[model samples]
Target: MAIIGILGTPYNTVERSPFWWNKVSYTRQSFIDVFQELGHTVIVLPVDKTENIKNYLPLVDKIVLTGGADVSPYLYGEEPHAQLGTTDPIRDRFELAAIKAALEANKPILGVCRGLQLLNVYFGGTLYQDLSLTSSQIKH
Candidate 1:
């Protein structure tokens, strides 16, 4: 079975939670179930545990960057827009590290939702931090 490294999303601890805000990185159970059902093992690449990201590169056949908070616009050399809402810089750093390691190792990577945005910026692409910042007629 192929091992899929899923980059975990970090979040603020909810009310009554014990974990510190932005200290936990996790993938949803549904993601784990779906991958396991398909006979692939899922490993969570935690945002707060990026120190060992390079070591993780050799263990998985593919990397899965899941949906999460908006990526930091600073990563793309742009200042954050007032409407940028929330962003997890910790998660950004973690995923970028993972992406670098994955490319150097020749491992395939998949991006979902916000993950796709970050991947684009990582590869010399830019994003309109907010749709309002763009001149496109379409609005979100």
Candidate 2:
């Protein structure tokens, strides 16, 4: 079975023993289901300290960046407009490092939703300030 590294959704945390995790992906479970259906092993990686991504990246054959949060507008070089959504700065840094690590390691990389935006930014590209206001009119 191909070992695939699936990034985990970052969640809000609670203050106590019953600390809670926030939901960060629309397709995390779905990806797991589909991957298992295809007979592959899925390894989930949650947000780790910025310096530790390399510890996990090398153990997998491929990297999959799942969707969640708003990509910080600053990342793509734009100021945050009123329409900008929630942002996860920690996850942003981690994923950026992960993607770069993936490239240096020469592993296959798959990105979804915000992941797509991150990839674009990492490659010296910019994002559409507003998808609906851009050339395409499809609702996300």
Candidate 2 lDDT score at position 139: 85
Q: How would you encode candidate 1's per-residue C-alpha lDDT over 93-116 as one tens digit per residue? A: 888988888898899999987878
- Model 2 — TM-score against the truth? 0.86
Q: Highest lDDT: which candidate?
A: 1
- Model 2 scores a C-alpha lDDT of 0.82
Instruction: Kindly give the stretch of ten consecutive residues in candidate 1 with the minimal lDDT sum.
Output: 15-24
Tell me how far the alpha carbon of residue 40 in candidate 2 is from the true structure, in angstroms, after superposition: 1.0
Q: List the residue pairs that clash in candidate 1.
A: none
Q: Where is model 1 more than 4 Å wrong at Cα?
A: 18-22, 135-140
Candidate 1 lDDT = 0.85
Question: Roughly what TM-score does model 1 have, to 2 decimal places?
Answer: 0.86
Backbone Cα, N, C clashes tallied per candidate? 0, 2
